[model samples]
Target: MKTPEPNACLDRLYRETGLTLRQFAQDVNRLGTERGTPLKYREPSVYQWLQGHMPREAVRPLILEALARRLHRPVTSSEAGFPSSPDQLKQPASTVQGLIHLGREDMDPSRRAVLGTGLFSVALTIPGWPDVVGRMKAIKTDPQRRIGQSEVQAVSAMTDRLSDLDGEFGGRYARPMAAAFLVNTVAPYLKASASSETRKSMMSAASFLCYLTGWMAVDEGAHGRAQEYYVKGLELAGASGDRRAYCHILRGMSVQAANLGHGTPAVRLANAAAEVSPESSPRMRAFLAGQQAHSYALAGEPTNAWNSLREAERAVNQAEGQLGTFGGFSSATLAYCTAEVRHALGDAKGSVKSLKEHFPLRDSTDTQRSKLLFSSLLAERQLEIGHLEAACATWNTVLDDYPALHSGRVDEKVAKIRTLLSPYRANSIARQTAERSRELLVK
Candidate 1:
């Protein structure tokens, strides 16, 4: 029998990670679980992979992601001694090409299950302002076509309409439509000849749309897919020199990290967003700082968390007379941030109080989906703080709208209602709440 040569490239990368064979195996297994596919690799599996045996194709990305997380940067298949998969071989060469590819994949129902396999890496390389400004690759322009401010306005308007739909309903249905628009309408516009000013405007408009699409993905719990869209948005925002848009997208990425309970990355991303744009308005400052407060709390930095929260409060107070900001950051939003901060810091009672304060401050323009999600959170906290009847009352309100919504996150919360109330089944209200949740789950 012939002896296979050891994988020198994989060996080198593995050494750089400073992980023992068993540690490396455990990392990959942990990441696989995060991606919803639990893995059980052991030291023997790592030894085989290092000894010139190819890892399973499905396990390659998890290995790369583990390495990336350890090294604090992206790790490619080639760099890790893995042969390029068919998808990697055909990777899009430019930002626009990549966006089109992503949109097409998202629009295809058959590809979605595959798309959901993407792993959200804590060390994913986020492009900085200097790294991406004017960085769009040379696109093959369509000689017969041209775009102007009107095209830019159309894209922006469509994004706003899509946002409204996502807010009222859920991303489950709105996302496919957004994907179609990106592939059909926006991709062509990106390739059409246009004046420099018009081109930047279009890119900026498209960037915001990308952010919205990623936000919708987050709503559906397709987190890894959401990170891909957010990175594309950041690239486009930087290419167009739209600092506001870039900062906004970075903040959105931070929100995603925080939502997934990855505190370190969340804090890093939030700080980057706040620091990168030095010319932000007070409202924008508040928007950024509120997220910073949440991220800091999650990371267990009590002093930093409290400081960031105070900064957000002051900034929002200063922003009172300003016209609506990018995310409509207001007193209500500040209150919600306060609730998140308190909760993360283990002050359950305070968290519930801040959450209660958030409701009355909300205006008519707020999204129904948010109202329900936050209400669910409030109920959970109310239960935690021994307000069983109050929790039941809040949950009943969520049930009224739960049947109509199709959010994965909302579904997760609704399902938990049963588990949380199970021990309290002797109480009439708790039993009724559990029954209501069971009925919904059965459907």
Candidate 2:
């Protein structure tokens, strides 16, 4: 069966308040800013909501908050046409509705938060083995237009393009594009005619795009929404029999957890992905192992971390294939993970060594974020090794990359650098750069 559309109640509330659609959007953005997300909503987004669209679960509460403040009364979920249970992507046959709702909210600048608000909790990432591995052989679908290989290929190509954009500039740049494509282009196709094989292929493709959306949500710092995307993507992936995508999505969640400093969840997700991973792709295996290593390091299990790193190295050496999507544990990714592991184990100099020796330096495209990250870490590591001048010099790259990116992840690196340099503020170079970072951040 096709997915259902979200119902609407926002129009009535707006009419009662006598605010223009534009004014209503402005109010939402204003309220969001005061609460720290600094949303960028405008008239069209609000118009869509008025026309029966549901905002994302995260945005709905804030939206109601905005409306209540404006109307001088309490605005509840029912009045806004939102579901009482806002644990998104969990309800049955709710995938399409959830996607549409999330799409509208993501596209609206007024609902934009700094991203990654919900900490990556184990509750969100770890699932029972039965739930994840439960696979359906064939979907019973018979849409009207007759879904074909061509449609599946189109979605795949679009997903690849979005992934490329993600690598180049990060999720902030790729998110709206993914959301719009899924909503306008893919949604109709999903709801329309197709045979079992076509449906399976299309479902897998849809699942992949959803995974991409979740990754971008994490990159842009919307952890709760990211988890929602992962859950729905996993459901679709299972039905499509796309074990690879399923494993990859789980690994993606692990990456989020690792970055959020929730080591146990990160390790749990990685281990789950490893258990379900197909043996055909050595590169994928390597990726999962590397992920495990990073998580173990985060968890302060140095022995496990070392063992996992060895396993990762072995798998990377054996890997021989055309690289898969999700970056395929590329050389650069391996180096990054290796550095991360070392850093987690408190080996500042070793992290620096691995970073410089193994870090991908050729064909510099779509890796500015990682490159800048390594440089920034190098600065910190240099400080750890008592090379203050070298540390200061290494920071130049980070400062250079700062203005070119719009990632919340990168903004976080900036914040850390500020704290790291505080004790040395008496030094001329340190004070100067600190001042410079302060000014740039203010802008």
Candidate 3:
């Protein structure tokens, strides 16, 4: 039998990473765990891969991602001595075309489970402003169709209505509808010819809807899918020269990373968002700074976190009575961000106080999903401080609204409530809350 030559490409990339064989294997194993498929590889496995032994197909992405993280750039399969995956082999040719493919897959009930299986990768490459800004190549337009500002306005109006539904119900029930809309209505519009002004307007509106859809995906606990949508949104935003939407999408990505407890990437993304748009309105500044504070706290940079928090507070104060900013940065939002920072920095009681401050500031504009999610967080912190009865009361409030919302995040919190109260099963309020949580979980 002929001996296969060593994988020179893999060896080259591995050498560039400068990691010990054991470290490389460990990194891959860690990434596998992050992907919910734990691995037990060691130095021998790494050596074998460098020696032309192919890793399992499913494991290749983990290896690529690990290398990408170490090398600080994208490491494609071909660069790592692996054949292109099916997805890559059939990759979409353009930004709009890719959006169509993603939306179509998301809209398909049969593909839903498969899409849910995509793993969130910390090493995923995000395009910078310079890389994507105003660089969308002209796409082939449908000669038979033409659109105008009315079509763009229609898309914007529909996005607003969808956002309301997502807030009132939950992403699980709303995301599919969004996907259907994107594929059925929006994608075709992108292919329809229009004046340059009208085209840019439509792209801007589509970018916002994409961000909303991605936000909904986050609520549904589909982080990988959310990232995909967010990237597309960023592309569209840049293509249309909409700096505000581009910054907004990047900030949204930061929020998603921070919520998933990925501190470093979260901080990187938040900084990118803030850095790209220095002349943004005070409210926009507050929104970006608040997220930066949370990311810094999660990354354990207490000084930076507090500084960012103060900046956010100052920005919010400066924006008082300013009405034109659309990102909705307010005192309530600042308080919530403060609570998150405090919690991340190990001040549980302070977090509880901040959360309390947040609740009263919230008005009719806040989503029901957020209201319940924050209430559940407050309950968890209350329980953490041994205030069992107080925790129970707060949890009851969440339960009152839980059944009506189909959010994966809210459901996760309710499940945790049951577990947190299990030790206090003898207490009546605790038992009742736990029981109700179990009932809801069953339903």
Candidate 4:
């Protein structure tokens, strides 16, 4: 490694982080990639930066975010001897920038380790959600070029195509393609000139893509990055005045929080979705109410949970008059959430009934990965209720589907099953099932 003089500021900052130079460099590269600019810095590179050499311009913001996270405080560019303005750089400055950043970073394989490692944060992620606000800013389009309805259609078309890919193949294969679409294609249109109507369509489509990217992030086991994308998607949807997209984004974020066990924030985000979309169709309300019930169950508030679930059923019924008005709600989604909430509330029988309701509907759909997920959910619930053989059957279902998927989300679920089976090593079926799961998981 090339040597540089021992420097004052860099040494002090490095010491404050308490990470060795190699570790610091790894973090810097990971954070840099997370900010849309992948870096290949090493210990020697850090020494050079500390010895008064300037780092690349894009890397400065990443250094700030990484340092702030490491030291648990805001980091200024000036403190790092970078030329950029010395303001908050930990968070992305704009929704567009953040979305673009997430797209670029998610495309890198090296940074995926960070994604796997820091998928949950109870304290930092949940409480940081902003209060109710609408349409905070307007998107400025580039006047140098003209964009038309064709461009907007293309974005939505690509989003639809990618959505199908995610359903069949899993997000591991689709996330980078989606990110590439956003970074290399959709991003330009977001900044290009378009008619007022076309602009809203573009923004809404972009928001939808960003939200899908967030979902993909979750599938790839990057829940922290997923949260950021959801926030940006919400803002973009809000900016476009797309109530449907905004509500959907909020619901997605709520699911992430609840999955991470941040129950209160999950509840707040779900309510925000409902509150912000007053004109929501009955179908939409059904979906949102179900989401709220999920969070309430996670929060251990059975009254609120059941109340929301009942409201969801009523909304679903009300929407029944309008054919195809289920919007985002389906018989499958309602039952899935019901099973989830019941399991969380420790209603084993209720969970089994709801899971039964869900399986038939979900099986009719083409997504095998979703089957792996809900099957594991049912397996865990069955095990909890002392149905060891039933749990083993569910485990077999998951293992059977496991080979077809390359999804981190499914991997995480099966991993939990492995842990769940550990205590039952004495049972021959449980031991054999766990052993088979381990072998398949390793492959």
List the candidate 4 regions with Cα displacement exceeding 4 Å.
1-92, 114-140, 321-327, 363-366
Give lDDT tens digits, candidate 4, residues 1-443.
66645456666787899888788899888765544456788998887777877677756656666676677555566676666554443554666776787788877766665444232333333222233133434657678877888888898888878877787778888888888898888888878877778777888888888888888888876777777777777777766778777777878888887876667768878997787774767788898999999999998899999999999988877775432311367678789889989888978889988997887765334366778888888888888889999999988988987888878878888788768989999999999898998898887
lDDT of candidate 3 over 224-324, digit per residue (tens): 88888999999888888888889999899999889988888899999999988746678888989999999999999999999999999998998966333
Better of 1 and 2 by lDDT: 1
For model 1, state the Cα shift of residue 405 in Å: 1.5
Candidate 4 residue 22 Cα shift, in angstroms, is 29
- Candidate 2 lDDT over residue span 157-185, tens digit each: 99989888876777888888898898887
Off-target runs (Cα >4 Å) in candidate 2 are: 1-93, 114-116, 125-144, 360-366
Error of 4 at 125 (Å): 8.4
Q: Relative to the true structure, how large is the alpha-carbon lDDT of every model?
A: 0.88, 0.75, 0.88, 0.76
Lowest lDDT 10-mer window, candidate 2? 134-143
What are the clash counts of all predictions, listed in order?
0, 12, 0, 0
Q: Comparing 2 and 3 by lDDT, which wins?
A: 3
Candidate 3, clashing residue pairs?
A: none
| Span of 10 residues, lowest total lDDT, candidate 1 | 320-329
Candidate 1 vs candidate 4: the lDDT winner is 1
Name the candidate, 3 or 4, with the larger TM-score value: 3
Deviating ranges (above 4 Å) for candidate 3: 1-53, 66-86, 89-92, 321-326
